[model samples]
Target: MEISFTPEIRRAGLAGAGARLLGVAAVLVSLLLLLAAGPPAAADTTQVRALLHQGQDLLRAGQNDAARPLLLQARTLAQKVHFEAGEIEALRVLGKAELVHGSFAEARAFLTQGVALARRTPGQPGLADVLLALGQVANEQDDYPGALRACEEALRLYHDQGKLRDEARTRNGLGIIYSSRGDFPRALAMLLPALHQTQQLRDSALQANCLTNLGGVYFRNNDARKALYYFGQALPLVRRQPDQGALADCLTNLAVAHQQLGEFRQAEPFYQQAIAVSERAGEQAQLGVVLSDYAQLLTDLKRLPAAQTTLERARALLEKSGDVGTLAATLVALGHLHQQLGHGAEAETQAHRALALATPIKDWSVQESAGGLLASLRKRRGDYKEALRYTELAQAAHDTLFTQSKAEEMGRLQGDYQLSQERERAQALARTGERQQQRLQAQQRQLWGLGLGLAAAALAGLALWRLNRLLGRKNQQIERQRAELTELNATKDRLFSIIGHDLRGPLHSLHAFVELLAGPPLPPDKLAHYTQRLTHTLDHTLALLENLLHWAALQMGAAGPPRPENLDLAALANENIGLLTAAAEAAQVSLAHSLTGEEQAWADPAAVRLVLRNLLANAIKFTPAGGTVQVSARRTGAVWQLAVADTGRGLPAPTPLQELRPETLPRRAGEGGQARSTGLGLQLSRDAAARNGGQLLVASAGPGQGTTFTLKVPVAETVEVPV
Candidate 1:
C-alpha cells in the first residue's frame, strides 16, 4: 500500500483557497501504453505499430504537440488498411494527449471516435482502453462524477482482461478524481492498491502518476508540507515520463507548493520552467492554468500590471482551448485581479460569468473563488442578506475542502499505507533468506491494509454524517429564508395598505376637484383656484401612482433586465434640473448643481433619472421658501457619489445605510410647516439606487439643519457597460 501521491494541482489561479495557487493537476494523467493490433494489409500492421509506439513514446516524453502528427498519421494509415484496432489505439492515445494538455473538446472528439470504432470491431473489449481515455478526459474537464463512472467501468474491464498494468492505471485515475472531488478517504483507498500494484511493474508512467496524484490529495487537504514532499518526489519521476504536458503541469504543482511554503525564490524558477515547458509543448492547459498561477506569484512579487497581462494571456489561451474548467479558473483569476484593481463591477462580471457556465465540470476552486468574490462585492454594496448566502456557499466549499480533523485522518491513512508498503518491503527482503520473517512480515502487510481499509470505511461513515449535518443545516437555512419571505409578504401587504391609504386622499381630492370644475359656474378667482387645485391633485395622484408602480414592479421582480449604460452625470443632472425648474420656482427654492462635467456613472439611465428626480423633488418640497436645493457629485473609487443637499427641516437623527432596508420605514428628510410628504419618494429613490448598483445615503443634523442625500452608483470609467 505504498502510495506515491501525485500533485493534485489545485487551480489557485482561481480566487478560491485564498490563492494558495493550485491544487495539482487532475488531468495530468499517465498516457496509456496501448498495444497496437490489426490484420496485415499492403501497409504492414508492424509498421503502423512501430509508428504508434514512437508517437506514444514522444507523448510520454512530454511532447504531445510533437506526438499528435505521428498519431494522426498512424490513424490515417490504420484507416486506409482497414485496421480498426490500430485506428482505435491511435485515436485513444491522441485523445489522451489532448486531455493531458487540457484540450477537452478535441480529446472528446478523438475519444468518441475511438469508442465508435471499438464498438464496431469484433474483438475483446477494446472498449476498456477507450473508456479509460474518455474517463481521464472527463476528469480533467471537471466532470468528476462522470469520470468516476467511466473509470470504474474501465477498472472492471481491465480486471476481466487480466491486465494488472491497465487496472492500476485505471485505479490511479479513480484516485486522482476522488481526490479532486474532496473525497480523501476514497482517494486513499483507490491510491493504496494502485500505487502498490504499480511498484511491482516496470512502468515509470504509472508510478509517477500515482505519486503525483497522492501529492494532489495532500494539496487538497491543505498539508502543503506533506504535499511538497510528495510533489518533490514525483517531479523527477514526472520528468522521466513527461506524458503529454505532465512535466509542465508538475512544474506548476511544484511552484505552487513552494509558493504556499513562502519560498518565492524557489517558486519562481519552477513557474518559469513550467511556462517554458508548456510553451515548448504548446499545451494550452499548462500555459493557461499554470501561467495564471504563475501570475499570482508575480502579484506576490508586487508586479501587479505584469500579473494582469500574464492572467489575460492565460485567459486568452484557455478561451481558445474550450477547457471550461480551466477557463472558469482563469475567469476567477481575472476577477481577483479586477478586485485588486478596484474594478468592482468588472470583477463581479467576471465572477458571475464563471458561475454562469454551470456544467458537470464543477471546479470547487472556481465555485469557491467566484462565491468568495461575490460575497465580498455584495457586502461592499451593503446587501448583507445576499452576502450571507454567498458567504455560506464559500464556507461550504471551504469546509468540504479539508478540516483539521479530516487532514489528521488523511495523515493516519497515509501512515497506514506507508507502514504496509514498508512491511511489503520487509517481506521481500525476508523472502530472500529468512522464512520466519517472511511469514511474520506477510501478516503485517495484510494487517496494515485491513486496518487502513477499516479506517477508510469509518471515514466513509463520518463523511455521510457530516453531509447529513450539512444538509440539515442547509434545510434549516432554507426554512428560515422561507419564514423571512413569509414575513416579507406580510410586510408588503402593510406597505400596500399604506400606499392605498395615501393614494385614497389624492384620488378623492382629484375626483371632487374635477366635479367642482365641471359643474360650477363660479366667480373668476374661484374658478381659477378650483382649476389650479384640480391640476395639483391630478399631478400629485400621477406622481404617487408612478412611484407606487415602480416600487411594486421592483418588489414583484417584474422589472425586466437592467439596461445600464455609461451616463454622464453632469448632463443627466442638468436635464433633471431643467425638468424640475418650474417646481423649484413655484416653491421659491433656488436649485443649483456643482457637477464638474467629468462625473459619470455606469447605471440604467432611466432608473437613475427616477432616483435623482425623486431625491431632488423631495429636497425642494422639504425646503422652505427662499431655501436652496443644490446638486453635486464626486468620484469615489469605483463609484460616483451624487449628493443633493437641501436647506430644510432636517431628519430627527442620523440615518445609517443599514436603515435603508425595505423593512425599515423611511425617515423624512425634514418635518416643518413648509410641506408634508408621504415619504414614498425617498423609498422610491433608495430602491432605484439599489437597482442601479448604487445606494442612497441620508445624512442630517436634528431638526432645521440641512439634509444631504447622496446617491452612490458605479463609476463609468469607460463607455463599456458591465454585464
Candidate 2:
C-alpha cells in the first residue's frame, strides 16, 4: 500500500523466514550434523536448539510478543554454552520479529549484532541472511545507499556459494529497492532474471514476490495494464502461502494497479480484501496503509465524502502505529481529499502536518506531494509569492531524488558490464571443451594469424599517426583564423561605441534644444561667460548631432532620399566656428571664420553641417597651443567650397587615417606629441558627402605644415524675379 519499499513487506516475502521453514528444519540439520561429528553434547547445545526452534515458530506465525521472550532466552542459553550457531539464529529471528512489528531501529540493532557474531565465526553461512535483513531495515528507513551496499555484498556471497535460489531472492529484493527509487529500467532488468530463476526453482512465494515488485515498477512507470497483469498473477500465488502480510501486499498492489488503469470497480474488492487481511493480522499500521491507497480510488470516483471518511480512519490508525513515512503520506492524501471537499483552509492545514513530518525524516516523496498541494492552495488564493516559494521547495526535493536514482543506475551499469564479461568467459570455456582434439592444429594456424594481425596493426598505427599530424596542423590554422575574426569584431564594436560616446555631449543638452525652441533664445553677452560658452557649445553640438544622425540613417537605408536645399554656406560656417570656439580655447588654439554673404550651395543642410563639424572638431583637437584654426567659404565656379585649415600636425598620405579600424592608433606628431586618431568620423563625413551629390577633399603640405579639409557642393539654380 505504501508505494515505497518497506522492510515489513520485503521480509514477509522472498527473504528471511519466507525462504524456508527454518524452525524445525534448522534445528534438525544442526542436530544431525553434530551427531555425525560426535561433539557438542557436553554443553547441552540440544536444549539451546530447542529454544531457537520454539522462538522461530512463534515468529513465523506473526506472534512477535510471544516470540521475543523465547528468542531472548535462546540467545542467553546459547551464549552460555558458546553454541554460536544457535545464538546467531536466535538473534536473527529476534530482529525478524522486531522488523515485522515495524520497529526498524530495534530490528537493525539486533540484526547488526547477529552479523557481527556470524562474521567472527569462520565460514558462517548465516551471514548472508543477517545482511539481507539489515538491508531491508536500511531500505525501510530510506537509507538507500547503505541498503545497496549490504544487498550487493550478500548477492556476491550467494553467487560464490552457487546458491542460485538465494541469489535470485537477493535480486528480487534489489529490484524492489530500485523500483522504490523510481528507476524502472534497471528494476525491470533485475526483476526479469529473478522472476525467471524463481520459475526454474518452482518457488511460488518468490515468484509472487518478483511479480508484485515488477508490477510496482510498471505501475510507477504509468504502464497500468502491464502492472495489472503482473499484480493479478501474484495475488493467487500469494494466497497459496500462509503469510497473510504477503497476501495483503499483493492485494493492495493489485488494487493500486487497477486504480491506475481507471478500473475502480475492479479495484474496490482487492482493497477490501487487503483491509480484511490486515485486520485479521491485527496490524493497524498496515491497515492504515491500505486505507490511504483506497482513498485514492475513492477520490477518482468523485466520491469525495467517502474518501474523506476513509482518510480520517487511516490517519488515526497510522498515528497510533508510529509509522512516520506512511503517516506523512496519509496526511497528504487527506489534504487532497479535503481539497476535493472544497475545504481549502483545512486542506492547507493537513498539508502542513504532512510537511512537518516528512521534512525531519527526509521522506522526499511525501514532502514533494505536500509542498505541491500547498503551492496550489496558495496560488488559488492569489498568494503568488508563497506559491513560488513552495514550488521551488518541491522542485528541489524532486531533483534530489532524481540525482540519487541516476547515480544508482550508473553503478548498476558497471556491475552489469562485469557480469556480462564473466558470462562470456564461461561460454568460451565450454566452447574450448567441445573442440579439444583440434587444439594442436588450431595452435599452428593461430601463430600465423598472430603474425598477420601484428603486421596489420603496425600499418594502421602508421596511417593513424600521419592523420593525427595533419589534423593538428589544420586545427592550428583554424585557431588563427578564429582569433583574427574575434579581433576584427572587437574593433568594429569599439568603433560604434566611440561614435555613441561622441554623441553623448550633445544628447545630454538635447533638452536645452527642446526648451529653447519652445521659449526665448539667449541675448548676446547677457549670461555669464561660462554659461555663454556652454550655450555656444550646445548650438554647434545640435548641428553636429542632426547631420551625424541623418547621415547614419541614410547609410543604413533606413530613410528616403536626402532633401536638397539652397543652404547658406556663410551662415553654416559662422555657426560651426562659434561651436568650435570653446573646444579651440580648451586646446589653446585660436579659431576664426571668413564667410561672405554671397556663398550658398544646393545640398542637404544636415549633411553639410556634419562634414563642417567633423573637419572643425578634428582641427581643434589636433591643433597645438597658440595655433590657429580658420574656417572659410566661397563659390568656386558652379559649386560652393568650404574649407577648414588648422596649424597643427598635418595629415598622413590620406589613405591610412581615412580607413576605420580600432588599431588605427595615434601617430607621433611634430610638436603636439603623439596625437589621437581623427578616426572614422572623417570616413563617415566622406561617405555622407558622396551620398549627397558632393565630395570632401583633404590637403596638407606635410606633418608640420597643417592640413586643410574642403567641402564642395552644387551651386543653387535661381529663377529671375520679373513681376
Candidate 3:
C-alpha cells in the first residue's frame, strides 16, 4: 500500500486468487476421469478430495466466491463419509477463501476448528497444510506471535514427516514473516534454504514463489543487488506459470531494484511491464501502487508530463478502490511531480492532502514522505521557518525507523572502511619495500662508477653552462620580438574591428536614405527628413574615418600634434548638439546644451567635438524615448570643464576609465540597442585631450541613473591660433 520496494505491504496479494485458477482447473480435470472410472467404496473420499483440492485452488486463484460453496460442499461430503483428512482440507480451504474475501471472523473460526481437528488426528499430512494456511491468516490479522508459532510448528512437522515440498513452502512463509518483523537475517536464512528446496522439487510455481520471497527478503535487508538477482531469476519461471499477479510483482521488484541502483533506463521496461500486467488483471490496488511508483521513477528521469499522467491515473484508481494508504502515497508522488514542474501552489496542496490522509491512518511512511515534500515546497516558497519545522518532523519519522539499527549500519560501514585501508596499507608497504631494494642497488652502482665518471662529469658541466648561456640570450631576443609583434597584431585587430563593424553601420544608413530618395516621390517633410538623415550618416561616417586615421597614426608611433586654438567652449558644445539633433530626434530623446560665453579652452577643436559626439551618441542610444540629454561647459578656475550628461541608462558598475586605449571603450547597449562601444572614438578623444595638456574624466550615478563625461583642459592665456 505504501508503494516503492522498501517497507513492503503486509498482504500485497501478488499471488492473487486469479493467478492460481489454471493450476486448480488442471488438477480438477485430471481427477474428473478418476470419478468417471467407477463408483467404488472410495467414491465419496476421492470426490471429496478432488472437491477440496479444486476449492483450495479456486480460493488461491482469487475466485473466493466460487470456492466458498465448493469447499462447504466438500466438507459436508467428507462429514457424511467420515473422512477426517477430507473434512480438515475442506475446512482449511474454506478458511483461506474467507480470508481472501475479508471475512476474518469466519476464517478464524474455520481455521481454528481445522487446527483443532488436525491436532486431535495427529500424523495427518494435511495438518502441516492447515497450519500454514492458518499462519497466513494470522499474519494478515497482525498476530505476529501466533503466525510465527504456527509457521514454526508447520515447518517442523513437514520436516519430521519428510514432506520436502510442504517444508519448503513453510520456510518461504516464515521468511516473509521474519521480513515483516524486521528480522532480515533470519528471513534470509529461511528464504535461501526454501529456494534450494523448491529447485529440487521441480515445481516452477513454488520455485518462482520462493525466489520472489527471497527477493523480498533481500530488499527488506537493504540489499537491492541480491534482490534484483532473485527477482530476475523468478521472472521467467513465474511468466511460464500463468500467474500474472506473481509476474507483476516480480517485474515491479526488478524495476525497484534497478531504480535503487540508479539504472533508470533499465528500470523503465520493468515498470511498464508490471503496470500492463496489473491493469490487464484489473488489480487496481496493486496497479495503483505500481502506477504511483512508476510516476516517481518518471519524475526522477525528468519525464514530468508522463509522470503527471501516470500519477493522475493512480489517483483515480486509488479513489475508486478506496485505498487511502496508496492514495496518500500517490498524492505525495504527485506533489513531488508538481514541485519539479514549478507549480508551487499545487504541490503544496497535494502535500497537505497526503499528510491529512496519512496522519489519520497512522502510516508513518506516507507521513514521512508527505512531510518531506511539504518541507521542500515551503523552502521553495521562501518560508524557511515552516520548512524547518516540516524538515524536523520528517527527519524524526525517518530516524524513528532507522535509529534502532543505526549502530549496526555504522559498524558495518566502519568495518568496510577499515578493510579497505588495510588493503591500501599493505599495497603501499609492498611498494615501499620494492623501492628501497631498487634504491640500494642504484646506490651501489653509483659508488662503483664514482671515480670513472668524475672527469667526464666536470667536462660535461662546463660545456652545458656555455650552451645554456647562449640559449638564454637567444630566448630573451625572441621574447622581445614576440612582445612587439603581439602588440602590432592587437593594434591591427582593433583597426579591422572598428572599420568592419562601426564604419559599416553608418555607410548602410546613408545607402538606405539614398535608395529611398531615388525610389519615391515624397512629401516635403519626408524629403527633408531623409536629407537630414543622410547628412547625419555622412557626419557619422566622417567621424569614424577621422578616428581611424588617428588610431593608424598612434599605432605607427607617428601621431601628429593637436592643432589647438582658443575657442569658445560654449560655441563648440552648441555645434556638436546641432549635429546630433537628428539622431536624438530619431531616437525620441531630447538633446540640449547650456554653456557660458566666457568659458574658453585650449584644445584640438576636432578632438573635443569627437568626444562630445561619442558621449552624446551613447547617451541617446541607451536612454529610452522621451529622456533628456544636456551638454554644458563652465570655467573651473585655470581650466574649462566641458561636460556632456544624459538622463539615460548610465554606464555599468565600476565605470571604466576614459583611457586613451581601445580596451577602455565601454561595452553596453546604445540608442538602437546595439553595443554602445566605438573603440577609436573614446581612445582618440582621450589622446586628443592629453595632447592639449588636459585629461578626459568620466563619472556615472550607476546604470540607469545617467552618466556625465567631462573634458578638463587648461584655459588659453594667449590666443595661439585664429578661431
Candidate 4:
C-alpha cells in the first residue's frame, strides 16, 4: 500500500524544515559574506559597502571577536575611501561588538564617533542603527539617562522613515534600559508592544529578543512566574537559530528567575548550560558573568570550595577580558565566599580590592556590594562603630540609586502618556460628532481619563496647600529648637571655661614652688623640709582641682578619658607613696607597700596615681598613732587586684556597698570631721577605671575592723609605642 502524504502534513513538515534551513543559510551566508568582502580597496567606495555587509554578517553569526576586527578595518578603509555613510555603519557595528565584549569605554568611543559621522551624513539609513547601538552600549554601562536619550532618538528616526522593524528594535532596547533601571511598568509597556510587532511580522529571532527582554522586566518586577513563562517561550525560538547566543542569554535569565524563586535544582542546570554555551562560543566576558553568578549561587548553597574555585576562574577570565566591572563583581563574590568559609581577613582583602576597582569605575552597584561585605567583615571582628559608619555609606548609595531610578521611570512614563494624550486630543478634533462622543465616553472609564485627571489635580492642590501649612509650623519649631540648643551649648562652654581658669591658678602655683625648690638657691636641710611640706600640700590641692575639673566635664557631657596604656603599677604606687610619706609620718601611720605577684594591668597611669594618693591620704588622715596602711597588688586570673588596706575608722553605720552611687564616693568626712567634700577624687577614679574596662570596689569587715578599697583592673599584653 502506497501511503499518500497529505498536503497539510507536508506543509507542516516543510515549514519546520524551512525554519531550520533558513537558520543554517543565515549562518553560511554570514561566513561567506565576511570572507568574500576581504580587505577594502583604498579608492573603491563600493568595497566599503561590501565590508559593511561582511561586518553585519559576522555580527549576525555572533562572532563579535571576528566582527570587531573586520568592522574596525572597514571603518579605516571607509575613512580612506571618503565613504562617510559606510564609516558610520562600520562604527555602529564596532560599537555593538565592543558592547557585547563588555568594553564599555571602547564601545562609547566607537558609538560617539558613529553618531557624529551619521549626523554629518544626512539621510543615511545607518543613523538609526548607530543610535540604537549607542543606546545599547549606554544601557550596559548603566548610563540609563544616556541610553533613554539614544533610544528615543533612534525610535523617532525609525518612525519618520517608516521602518517598523527598526522601530520595534529601538522599543525593545528602551524596554531593556528601563528594566535595568527598575522601571518595570514602563518596561512592560514598551516591551509588550515590541513583542506583538515582531510576532505579527513573523520574525522568530526578533520575537525571541523581545520575549527575553520582557522576561527581564518581569524578573526585575519580582514576577518570577511571568518571567519564567516568557523566558521559556523565547527558548524554543532561540534554540532553532544556529547562533544560540540568545539561547544562552535566555537560559541564564531563566536560571536567575529560578534562583529567585528558590528552585536551585532547576537553576543550576540552566546556569551550567549558559556557561557551557558561553565557553564554546569563546565569549570570555560573558562566561565570566555566568561563572560569577553561578559562584554566588554555589556560595548560597554552602558549596564553599566549588564557589571559590568558580569565582577564581571567573576572575582569571575577567582579568584577561579587561572587563573591570564584572571583575570587581567576581572579587566581591569571592569575598563573600571567603566570608562564608570563616576567613575574615581574606574576605576583607578581597572586598577592599573590589572596592578599589569599583570606585574608579563609578559602578555604584559593585561599590555598594563590596562596601557592604567589608562592613560585615568589620562587624564580625567586633567593630560595630566602624560597621555603622560603613552601613551609612552603603545606605546612601542604595538611596541614590533608588531615587534616580524612580525619577527616570516616572519621567519616561509621564512623557509617553502625555504624548499619547496629545495625539488623542488632536484625533478627537478631527473626528465626526458621533465618533467624538463615543471616544469621550470610552475615555471617561479609562484609568488616565480626563475626569479622573481633573479630580486628581484638585486633590493634589489641596494636599499641597495643607503640606505647606504643616511645613511652616515645622520650620518655626525647628528654629526655636536651634536657638535653645545654641544657648545650652554656650552655657556648657562657659561652665568649662570657669572650671579651667579656677584650676589653672592652683596648678601654676604648685609648679612654681616645685621649680623654685628644685633650684640651688637654698640650704639643703631647709630645702628638704620646706619641699616635703610644700609637696604634701601641692598633691592635695592638685588632686582636689583635678577632680573638680573632671566632674565638671562629665556634667557637661565632655568626659572622654584617654585610652589605657601599659605602665608599671609598682612605680606609680611608689611615687604616690613618696608624695604622701610626710603626711603619713605626721599622722603616726606606718605606710607599707608590697607586691605579692608579678602584676601587670592596663589603666590610665595618672588616674591610678590619683586613686592611690587619695586612699593613702585618707588613711593617713583618719589613722591613730602607730596605725598601719598597706598598699599591695596580686594577680587574679587575667585581672590585677590592687588593694589599699587601712586600719582606720571605716564606718559610722551600715554602709552601702554595691548600692553606692558615684556622687557619694568623694563625700567622706576628714580627720577634722568636716562633712564637705573638697573635690570628686573618688568619683573620678571610678569613672577612669570604668573607662579602662575595669571597676573599683570598696570592702570592709564592719565598723572598725578596717576597709580595703580594691581596684580590679584588666591585664593585657604590653604594647610598645614610639616616643
Q: What's model 4's lDDT at 5?
A: 10
Candidate 4 per-residue lDDT, tens place, 1-723, comes to: 011111111111124465455445544554565566645553356566666676566555555554566667778877876888778878877776666666779989998988987787767648877887777666666566677778888889989998888778778877766676666787888889899889888899888878877887777778999999999999999998887555678889989889989988899999999999998899888888899889878877888899899999999999999999889888988898888788998889988888889888777887778878877777667554466456645654655565456556655655455556546646654564455456445545554767787875666567557756865786687679768766665545444433443344335445545544554465677567556655555555665666667656755668565567776777778788888887777677888889633556677776677677777776776666778999998778888888888887775554544422444544454453222344356666676667666778776666776767788877758634324
User: What's the lDDT of the predicted structure labeled candidate 3?
Assistant: 0.74
Off-target runs (Cα >4 Å) in candidate 4 are 1-164, 177-181, 380-723
- Give a tens-digit lDDT track for model 1, residues 448-502: 5777767655665675577568657866876797687667655565464555455
Rank order (by TM-score, best first):
3, 2, 4, 1
- 1 or 2, which is superior by lDDT? 2
lDDT of 3 at 708: 78
TM-score, candidate 3, is 0.46
User: For candidate 2, lDDT tens digit of each residue in 1-723?
Assistant: 011244335433324654345444544654554455435555457766666776666565555665687678779878888888888888888887887788989999998999999999978848888888888888888776667767878889989998889889889988988787666887898899999999999999788888988887888899999988999888889989988877898899888888777789999999999999999998898899999999888888898898899999999999999999999999998998888788999999999999999999999998889989998998778654476568757765765566556555645554454456556656865775455435534544555577776765665567557756865786687678768755655544443444444344334334433433344444544334425445555644554455556545655577677799888887888888887787677668988887766676789998888878888877776778999988887677898777888888775544321323313435342233222342556767887788898887777777568878888889877622324
The CA lDDT at 398 in model 4 is 58
User: Candidate 2: minimum summed lDDT over ten consecutive residues — where?
Assistant: 656-665
Candidate 4 total steric clashes = 0
Q: Among all windows of ten consecutive residues in candidate 1, which has the lowest summed lDDT?
A: 21-30
User: Candidate 2's C-alpha lDDT?
Assistant: 0.74
Using TM-score as the yardstick, the better of models 2 and 4 is 2
lDDT of each: 0.73, 0.74, 0.74, 0.71
In candidate 4, which residue pairs clash? none
TM-scores, in order shown? 0.36, 0.44, 0.46, 0.43
